[model samples]
Target chain A: MAAHRKRTKGTVVVDTVGIVGLGLIGGSLARRLAQRGIRVVAWNHRPHPYAQAEADGIFCKSTLAELMTAEPDVLVLCNPLKAMPAILAELKPLLDEHPATTLTDVGSVKGMVRNQVKAAGLADKYVGAHPMAGNELSGWQAADPGLYDDALWAVTVDEPTDYRRFFAVASLITEGVGNRIIVLDDETHDKAAAMISHMPHVVSTALINELTANPDRNVAAALAAGCWRDMTRVALTDPDRTRAMVEEDALNVEVLLRRMASRLTDMADQLHAEQDQGSIVRGGSLKGDAAAHIRKFFAAGDPFRRYKAQTSSAGDFPARELEIPEAGWQQTLLFSARRGEAITSFIHPHQAVIQIRPAI
Target chain B: MAAHRKRTKGTVVVDTVGIVGLGLIGGSLARRLAQRGIRVVAWNHRPHPYAQAEADGIFCKSTLAELMTAEPDVLVLCNPLKAMPAILAELKPLLDEHPATTLTDVGSVKGMVRNQVKAAGLADKYVGAHPMAGNELSGWQAADPGLYDDALWAVTVDEPTDYRRFFAVASLITEGVGNRIIVLDDETHDKAAAMISHMPHVVSTALINELTANPDRNVAAALAAGCWRDMTRVALTDPDRTRAMVEEDALNVEVLLRRMASRLTDMADQLHAEQDQGSIVRGGSLKGDAAAHIRKFFAAGDPFRRYKAQTSSAGDFPARELEIPEAGWQQTLLFSARRGEAITSFIHPHQAVIQIRPAI
Candidate 1:
């Protein structure tokens, strides 16, 4: 252990960091760590980014063996998912040589990786992490010191794993990199990822394929409205990176796609049945409850969407100075439905904690 | 027609305009027409927006027959799809009684509407129109006089239909309402709408459905991250309006979904076979060309998306000031290497039309 090694977050200290596969996440971590006066020795497959990183004053190593010899306190694996196992195997020797050096991976998928590391009896030294961050852009050029800020990083661990080891790795990444730490089992993480990241990526990529699948590719492209741009933002990532992420969790995505297919089929059937009954037409269309089923189907998710918009819609929240004015003076009560269901009120001259529900 | 009627949009002219269905589109149109000093009479199924429109100083009529009695030069139907036909039927005797009145609809799906008008022998007085405009919100409060600005208003008509009549309607919308006119036939318009508007809506709704389908709705919502919000923006429309629009084109959306389903199935199969071969590991993963198929699938529409971004992305253009003074001293020079093509060189005191094809 180096004398410069100071506790960064809850029981986690690292003076020398070894960053492998220095692309966006690795490079970003390196940049932030170096800024915080921690030593980062790096290696990237491509020699150009390696040169750039070296020029930026990082100690660039040519090989993983050489990087391990730098006596790092921790190693961060930022390699593509498919390449992680081999990288981990290469790292096995270093772990044997330096038993104190711990490890973690930033791959999106974790179940198989956790299993592999667990089988290797290295679960004591490892925790699987995925920071839900990054723009559509990737690679070293896209790396930012603030990349992981305000993002949720899932710290996945199996049962019977070393909780202390998990906390050490998780705290370093979450507190050091400024991500909110969420503890989830590997399988739970994968299911959630399938819904949020992997499934959406599938839909986006499939959407592009569907539009271009027709000979009307150019015509369809002409009709690419506002919605298409935002929806396909995820599909614009580095091809190799996308493939690696999607490939690691293909089966789960397949199940998700099948489920989505069944839903679409059901909606289509409902629609066809209504149309066959000639209810999509004018005369008695309103009187008939044809659109009721479809509307109900859509309205189920309305609250969730509204809740997200009220809280998560981008932009600065409206700020202004409000006057409470002399405490004893009477003032009209004001409250938003969004603020709370009820408010604490004091009656006439008696200061009682009375909860008053808003009439609105 | 009132003698105060002036020629608008080169041919189309109106003094009094009846804006039926005073929702976002109708209210916005009324606002714009009133601003142009035209007499704007309005009718809505609801009383609130009608009162609001009247308060906003547009002549608010109570019934369709009352709106007809006002003897407007043109009638704009801004009702939802299912309601449009009934509204149009209500305007029928008026159409016959006042032979000079022209009618146009702003409903999304146009084929059935156009056919119905043609079958009713009102094609000469009618042209189907849909403005590719609107924010996420609907209704009078969301209406803006600038709603149709920069949006394409598709003017759809059938064969043996009045080309002059179509232009009269198209020009009124494009020039009067400030929408860019795109003259597409009813079928072409429907197909384009299916690809652009209808299918995307279905997919948005379906995506939210898929994510929230399980008991893990909250979990799915928490993991919603980034892509979920943008991808599901369109699914947040008024449920009834969404149902009407989607149901009108459900068969087409079903077809589109099936196409999407097939492509998704094919991609899943490819991923599965690649995984089953154990080639998803480091040894042969990249070497096995597993990701190549997936990458190719995503890359097909990248150019189209990129091209659209380059053109449609609204922002200030890269501007630079060039000093071209004392024009007689003109020069033409050449730069070479455009990859296996010819090159031409010319430098002169007087510049002529110089064309150069460079070679590499």
Candidate 2:
């Protein structure tokens, strides 16, 4: 194993990576890994992308058995989440035959995928990861290695998770794929994913729905500018895809939506009160309870604004090493993530080089 | 007046235009008009930009009295909305002296500006125009002539608005600036502005505020991608500026925010019910009241999605002439705008060449 491993500044823990489903995300990953001089073996549901993928220096396999013959250190399930149960069932026996290969997946919802893996009796070999990448485009035709450039991934682990398996997957992301990562439990990953992506997609959809229902929709559409365009961009994508993603993480999205709805309602009340007391207010300043509340609402996000400004102005964030404690190492990395530290690479199994980024 | 106007394909109704407050919108308009060979006279609160503007062939005036002395066909008040009352007060006596100079402003909210113009006894000379252009940038230094390229201007009018004044401003937008015009009444303009821009700005701010208040904020921020960035872009701008914009159209914004809140809440309920019935549902095909409601919500915006697709694919929208009726001309043009027609040029005061755009 040591003789087969290649050495960069840090040891390349994942010398060979196997990828399933050569769609946008998977295809892009395969090409990127191959570009990075890592041996990549890929299999798609259909062989259409195989010829083009092989042309990019990736080894194309016809079956799961053949892919397993290559002895990939990390096998990524990049198939659609709907295909999870069937694929997991098929991979169960093959993975059992080669127990040394650590399993991982690039599914957006972590807990559900973990559950599926558990149901397939492959929990011991699995580590969950979701790259914060992709665009409005899909399919092998739209795949590009640049899609993973400067991407951050959330690596999910749990209490019963094997440290060796976790190290293998984390090192693959940080060193093999040359991407940053933050450790999280399945719940934290799914909830955070819901907060940032799924909930926002639903909100965007609601906005377009509101516009479509308006009597003067054409007038509103004509007057739409940067704000309207940016806020509703995600809604303009394939609704069926968005609907599936939202439904997959339905519980987390539901909670965030209610919170967002409450926030909007509170703002509406403040605005209403301000209008009612319009006669008393002078200039642009309102002098009432509603005015104070509105001022507070606007000021609440100042920390985030300042953090973004700092990040934009300060190029190349400062880096430091995080020592992963032997006991409860998952909690240590999660706490580091909460402090806005992103693990760039593993110097060794117990040590990680993290970049300290501006926090909200 | 006819002899002073320059002739292209259509009569340039406003040849010599007076501009006050040369900020982003004002400076861009001044430059674009000057580029088109229109005589532009400008007065700023300060003369910092005057030299460069003069080099661009704009006649810089030292005072409102001097700007009025230019005897411009149209006077555009482009100062900040906060300075509007003071500027209107100063312009009132000067405008009375030269009653032929039609007054207009590039304000976001038409109703409020109209009221300010009415308060100064200049409503009879006023027409409300809001160019659907601008960026996150501000000031004269950030201004460029190309900002007006392929832009839309909402020309707002009321029952008592003089035909010639409205025509002068509309023609100035359509002919002088070479842009499109959609005629609307003050209420409709304010409501639609709130719907597409103002209300969405608040929702975006709320989103950032929510993330800021989250316990796993750093985690979510780390996982943030295109959707989070796009939805929160407006919120990252000067909150004070966004607040002012929202407050100016307080009533309209309040109503729309409440509507958005209700929509979000409805979606939340559907998602919750869908999750509750997850056990009974097979494969991603949900069955229940929740499933039906969810499907309906996702499908509601299909018209808008289809309209966007059509507009993006079709190059160069079809154009035709629309004749204006003497009685209820305001309603006639409003109806034309409702039908998704944008006035490109006025062949005459009573006739407009409108482009047929895709509608929801």
Which is the leading candidate under TM-score?
A: 2
lDDT of 2: 0.90
lDDT tens digits by residue: candidate 1, B32-59: 8787677888888987876667767799
lDDT of 2 by residue, B1-360 (tens): 243244235666677999998999999999999998899999999999999999999999999999999999999989999889888999999999999999999999999888888998998999999999999999999989999999999999999989988888988888788899999999999999999999999999999999999999999998999999999999999898898899889898888888899999999888888888774223447678988898899999999999999988999999888999888999999999999999987777898878999878
Would you list the clashing residue pairs of candidate 2?
none
Off by over 4 Å in 2: A1-10, A279-284, B1-10, B279-284
What is the per-candidate TM-score for chain B? Answer: 0.78, 0.96
Q: Looking at model 2 chain A, report the run of 10 residues with the lowest lDDT sum.
A: A1-10
Best by lDDT: 2
| CAPRI category for model 1 | incorrect
What TM-score, over all chains together, does every model reach? Answer: 0.77, 0.97
Candidate 2: C-alpha RMSD after superposition: 2.7
Ten-residue stretch with the least lDDT total in model 1 chain A: A329-338
| TM-score of decoy 2 | 0.97
